[model samples]
Target: MLDIKQIREATDFVRERLASRGGGEESLVDEVLELDERRRRLLAEVEALKAERNRVSKEIGRLLAEGKREEAEARKRETRSLGDRIAELDRQVGEVEAAREALMLRMPNLPHESVPVGRSAEENVVVRVFGEPARHAFGPKTHVELCERLGLVDFARAAKVSGSGFALYTGRGARLERALIQFMLDLHTREHGYTEVWPPLMVGPACLEGVGQFPKFKDQYYGVAEGDDPSNLGRLYLIPTAETVVANLHREEILREGDLPIRYCAYTPCFRGEAGAAGVGTRGLIRMHQFDKVELIQVVRPEDGYEAHEAMVRHAERVLQLLGLHYRVVLLCTGDLGFASAKTYDLEVWAPGQGTYLEVSSVSNCEEFQARRMRLRYKDCQGVNRHPHVLNGSGTALARLYVALVETYQQADGSVLIPEAVRPYFGEERITP
Candidate 1:
């Protein structure tokens, strides 16, 4: 959410941002300003009427005490009228405020100045590329092919159980997933200063609203009904990101000044309904309805969010660097950025089998957009309450990273060489069936 004062004063700045997004450019700003104006005016009017009613009620009490019965009755009648008017205006104010908030929630975050101006990922500039994609002397195998031959994954059975875009890991595949989770958690908690947390996979609508996922990605989530009524189902949704839970842990609470920067990391299986996508490219574990991810979230002072964002990106890079994976970092163009992210950096890993780079993680700085919606705040040294800046990034996505690992480390004998980092977990240097 943007500061109301900033929206009013920086209307042109916000307008430019919406324009760059390529659609819905002209109407949103004007509609928001109009609704806000009406809300403020109604509130002022209602406050004045309440004040008048209070004054008259007291006068009526004094009049009755002085034995002025007729005057007191007249005052009572006037107070009753004021009460009715106040009630009507109160309802109007509520409606206007609700309308204003609806508009505000849909407004996208302002892009950072450094973000490239473009319409799609094709326009995104690669800031840096690491080691080259591993070369194969023979025909390279895709993740699906490698997993099937190695008895690591069962897709046909998974589809029978839960439809497409789901995978059933077997044998070493299950162990590999667990090993990756442990590897990432250990790295972040021990070396990165992030506290490990286990958060709920199912969350309430209010929590989604805080993270800017409710309105934007509603269709993509799996909503669960909350109410007991047969007709009026109370709905809940599976989390699409652990940040939705981590960022809202301190919602509506005021943290002490000493805890200026709170960092958290969690391993959770994210669920997303890739509704419209189907067929070839999404083959294998690349586009799954369920996938495990280790997420990193930080709550910091507003002034330090940008610096913190860069540091978080480095933490993500550290994971790839340690695993000996070849990848590249790209700055997401403004038009290609997520709705809530003012700026984003995507890390793409080279997949030899696919013959292309696949995105493995995205790190973003949301500034105060998420904190404002979550009502997350902290008390500064001066005893001032203010919203803390929030940032979240995928330290690494398990499934996509596996695509890079299997293809890059494949040997002539069909054995997979486990990275030195993961060797301790498997109790062997290579995965052989």
Candidate 2:
């Protein structure tokens, strides 16, 4: 959430920065300001009414003490009228405050100054490329073809059980998925200084709101209906990403300056509604209703936010580097950035069989945007409370990486060679039909 005070003080500057997004986000500045002004005016009126009510009450007491019962009754009647008016003003204040908050919640974070100005993914700038896509004399098979030939995934059965945009892994495919999850968890926890956490798959509305996922992208998530079970009767949503859970781990918390930077990684089966994306990249594992992901989250001092963001991007890149997958880092343009992120870097891995690069991860620095929403703060050395910056990135989404691995390591005989990094977890890794 943006600080309304900042918006009020620097309206033009805020609007200019948000204009780069080009979605009329700049126009929200005026709406928010108008609502805020109305709220303040209502609050001021309520305060004045309350002050008058207090003065009348004191006069009523004085009149009664002096045995002026009639005078006291008249003052009491006036006080009752003032009280009613104050109650009406208080209601108006509440309504205006709620409207202001709703508008603020819908507003996207302002892009960082360094973010490139562009209108779409086409304008995203590639920062670096790693390893060339593997070449083969024989044409590479798509993950779907390879998995089907090797009896690894059963898309047909998955469709029958859960409809399309879902996969049922069989035999080595299931084992490979498990191996990847363990490998990522171990890598992040052991080598990257991240604390591993296992969080709930379902969260309530406040949890989603705290992470800036509610009110704006609500349609993109699966919501759990209220059930007879007492514990489950509320507005619950299946987590779209582990970031939603891990980011709220410290919600409404105040930390010491020494603990300025807290890093956590979690593995979860993400669920997305994917509403309105019918037929776009729905084939294979590129897009799915249910997918596995390992997410990395960091809460750091404001000064260290950009540094932590860069480190997180490298941490995600390291997963690809260790697996020998060809990938590139892209700096997202303002228009292409996520709602909660001030800046983002997308890691796109080359898919030989698909003949394209698919996004495997997005690392973002949300600065204090999420922290403000979650009320996550830290006490500085001088004991002043301040909002900390929050950052999250996928160590990698398992489905796309699975696609890259299968296509990159497939042999002409239709067998798949597993990468050395995960061989120990897979036991004997050259999966053959």
How close is every model to the real structure, measured as TM-score? 0.96, 0.96
Weakest lDDT window of 10 consecutive positions for candidate 2: 226-235
Error of 1 at 222 (Å): 0.8
| Candidate 1 Cα errors over 4 Å, as ranges | 225-234, 278-282
TM-score of 2: 0.96
C-alpha RMSD in Å of predicted model 2 compared with the true structure: 2.0
lDDT of each: 0.88, 0.92
lDDT of 2 by residue, 1-433 (tens): 9989899999998899788898888888999999999988888888888888899899999999999999999999999999899888888888988888888998888999999999999999999999999998899989999999989899999888898889999988999999999999999999999999999999988888988889788888887876566566446889999999999999999999899689999999999888899663355888999999999999999999999999999999999999999999999999999888999999999999999998999999999999999999999999999999999999999799999999999998889999999999998769887
Which pairs of residues collide in model 1? 224-236, 225-234, 225-235, 226-234, 226-235, 227-234
The deviation in Å at residue 338 for candidate 1 is: 0.5
